[model samples]
Target: MRAHKITFAALAVIAGLSLTACQNDDDAAAKTDPSPVTTASPSSGDSGSDGSDPASPEASSGGKDTSAGTGSDKPGQAAKCRTDGLKITAIDNFIDGDPDGTVAVEMKNTSGRDCVIAGFAGVDLKTNAGTLSAERKGEPGDPYVLKSGKSIAFSVTYPLNETGGSGVRITGLVVTPPNETKSVTLPWPGKPSLPVTDGSGDPVRVGPIGSAGQGG
Candidate 1:
């Protein structure tokens, strides 16, 4: 009976050790294995690896900004009218084989790009006796953007002949562009006779430059 008790006690101790081993195994598995996670955490303010918030101006602009750069794809503002790109033509004849004293002035854009043109074109009718500056008439309208191969027409008004009066001789002429300091020189229109001014004030009258089909 004592031997049976000893055997039973030994069996009980063995069972206890097996249960402890099972408990230790379960704890190790829980510590090593990963828990179930369904989704990733949401990003905060689109921060970069350098911890910079994307919304900040420094982060958005970076070290070199390209918003105002010329190479950017964004559209830029229109450029102002320039004189060197203009081609001035003196129109003395309304049609072939006919001549008039109104001296029509026309300009063509040769800059190969779009440019703004406004106000009156400067006209200096040079003569041997005296030089006449154009007296501008009326206010300027909205600016006209002229592309390549486009043209605008204007006029300088003066009498062609005086009828028994000593007429002024036409020599060379000077043309000035609007809002520009440079001037273009053109030859005389075949020595046409112009009305002589009394030296009172500016003689030649200039019409405000307008688009095609628009009269001044």
Candidate 2:
């Protein structure tokens, strides 16, 4: 009977030890294996809500500002038109060869006093390609002396070899009275003139009678 009691106590002690060891093991596992902490990802749309990135071009480039500098793409950026007292009264297109044509530019001294045009009046023909055909000197007359409010006319012609469109530019009227230079640019019909050079290092050739002067 005593031996049986001793065996029963020993089994009870062993069972208690096993329960305590299991409880200790459970506590150790709870401390070592904690719940994982979550992290944000770029694809998860988590950056916008936070104040990290301001989400602007300036912010992306280290807060450096970007703007159009001087002479930017804006209206009214072109140079304004400049005009002097000299005036061009008329530019007449006269007959040349058969079906082709020519142009004669008539300039008038519109100023009240007599103006001395020291240099030769020049005519530049601009082509469709924006290329200048040649510069011709106008038929220079005697030093034009005009009475106040009176006018005198000077003419220059450009000849066309073939039928098409060409642009005409008239310049080089150096008015000595006001000491100013004036020019006029217009589009007219004509073919390119034959290129030539002159003694003054300017081009000079007899074009269709009207298109005469220093060639470009």
Candidate 3:
């Protein structure tokens, strides 16, 4: 009976040791396992590693601004009109090409873009003797915004030569547009010779630049 009790006690101790070893192995496995990882997402205003922000002024401008300033696509900001971009012509409005007539000079904008013109046009009659400059005779008013394919005009008025007296023989005309230094030459539309001195003995007169198809 005593021998049987000793064997049972020894078996109980061996079972306890086996259970302890199992618990120690479970603890070691828990310590060696790795944890779960986490990552964050970028927000709307957040800048990435390159230090760029979507809401910033520099970013919104796309590194270059092309919508403002001169030469841009903005309206009414065109450059001034130049003589090289203009087409000038003249029409004599006298009955039977006689004196006491008016010469209507028209300037058309041939440039592909918009431009501006203002004030009086410089006028000089090309004659055999010399170039006779016509005197400016009215207010210039306001600056005119001449769009592409548009026109403006000025006029020259002279007295009638009823006596048939000796006068200047006009061959051509030298025209200068408003606010421009360059000039253009055009032929006189009608009778070349007109009395230099009027019935009252006065020189010819010129007018300011105005709308086309109108007097001066």
Highest TM-score scorer: 3
Query: Model 2, range 1-216, lDDT digits (tens) per residue?
Result: 111122566657667577678567667776776667779775653332211222223211122111211111134221111125345433344454534333443333444433233224444544333334334344423222222233333334333333233323323222111123455655443333422323333332212211222111
Q: Positional deviation of 156 in candidate 3, in angstroms?
A: 1.4
| Stretch of 10 with least lDDT, candidate 2 | 64-73
Candidate 1, after superposition: displacement of residue 60 in Å?
43
- TM per model? 0.56, 0.35, 0.58
Candidate order (lDDT): 3, 1, 2
Supply the global lDDT for candidate 3: 0.62
lDDT of 1 by residue, 35-91 (tens): 666798986552222211112222111121112111111234334457788788775
lDDT of 3 by residue, 65-108 (tens): 12212222333355566899888899976677554667888877
Model 3 spans > 4 angstroms off: 1-76, 95-99, 196-200, 211-216
Q: List the residue pairs that clash in candidate 2.
A: 135-216, 136-214, 137-213, 137-214, 203-215
Pairwise lDDT winner, candidates 2 and 3: 3
